[model samples]
Target: MKAVLVGILVGLATASPVSLHRDPWDPTIKLPSPTQQLVWGDVNVLHTTDIHGWISGHSKDVYPEKSWSGNFGDFYSFVTHMRQKAMTKKSDLLLIDTGDRRIGHGLTDHIFDPKKANGQDA
Candidate 1:
């Protein structure tokens, strides 16, 4: 039992940083581009959904939640840097976001000041 636990911990510790999604480095792997004449057996796709407006990440210093402490600003910076690096390496990469633009959180719910309640800019 102890050996199994240790193995699991070691395995997790060395996992790749990239998720199962499109490896931002795939295009630079020297593989031929997909062609009409050739068929591929397997492909990988990654999806992130139901993000809501949690772009700023949970502010509360809670466990697990705090693990994803990256806010939208951090995400934006990360994507920008990744895209630039991919471009330099001639890699094909795509970044996408799902729907649900608004209607949550104090910022959205408190569109108008509760004291005013007249749609006036506070």
Candidate 2:
């Protein structure tokens, strides 16, 4: 776990970032590609956290906001590819998501009327 985190940090630190999506609504931003090739072991973990209800991801063309343009479908595609890679390598891959379901963002917070099932309608 520690090694994976370190690898990601190093990748982020050394690589020139880029954006993956080219949606009309999303701002043009470069996606990040790791400078160093990531090492895969017999067992691997792919983790995601926070999210803060950014299912559609950041649409604004601002600095940090534009970076996370890939949405849930993109995330699913990535996981699928990773799973296929792990299968070919005969390794175990696990995906974990720490909580924080619906907290921020207008999609989750403001789209639904609170009076309707305490936002369960969302």
Candidate 3:
């Protein structure tokens, strides 16, 4: 019982809450005016490349690859939310994409059946 109580107390002290709030009029906390701040002094950049059709995630269900299969739609939503958060915190944020943009998939290939020769009989 004593050990469990100690563990609970330790966890509570070390845990960080998801959100924090400060009193707006607190004299010690001076909000910086726009003119006094450097707009891009400290910036954060995110880059993704060679993504291919991975927007739907890799098909293989193994370890790290399995973990990433969460899909591109989730990633886009995450980025949108994070950018909004960065803007709220008055920080510079940039996202970049690079490399080949082609999508290779059965859906794309089947658009024109290969069995038909020269748009005529197979």
Top lDDT hit = 2
Q: Report the C-alpha displacement of residue 119, candidate 2, in angstroms.
A: 17
C-alpha lDDT score of every prediction, in listed order: 0.57, 0.74, 0.65
Q: What lDDT score is found at residue 71 in candidate 3? A: 71
Q: How do the residues 12-120 of candidate 1 rate in per-residue lDDT, one tens digit apiece?
A: 9998786454333345646557777422223322245556556778786654566567777887787777666666666655665543323233333346444444334
Q: Over the full model, what C-alpha lDDT does candidate 3 score relative to the true structure?
A: 0.65
lDDT (0-100) at residue 96 of candidate 1? Answer: 55
**Tens-digit lDDT track for model 3 on 29-103?**
687778765344357777866665676777975444654675778878888986887788788788876533243
Return the TM-score for candidate 2, rounded to 2 decimals.
Answer: 0.55
Model 3's C-alpha root-mean-square deviation from the true structure amounts to: 14.9
Better of 1 and 3 by lDDT: 3
Clashing pairs in 2: 18-30, 18-31, 18-32, 19-30, 19-31
In order of appearance, the predictions have TM-scores of 0.42, 0.55, 0.45
> Stretches of candidate 3 above 4 Å error?
1-41, 101-122
| Model 1 root mean square deviation, Cα atoms | 13.5
Candidate 3 to truth, TM: 0.45
Quote model 1's TM-score: 0.42
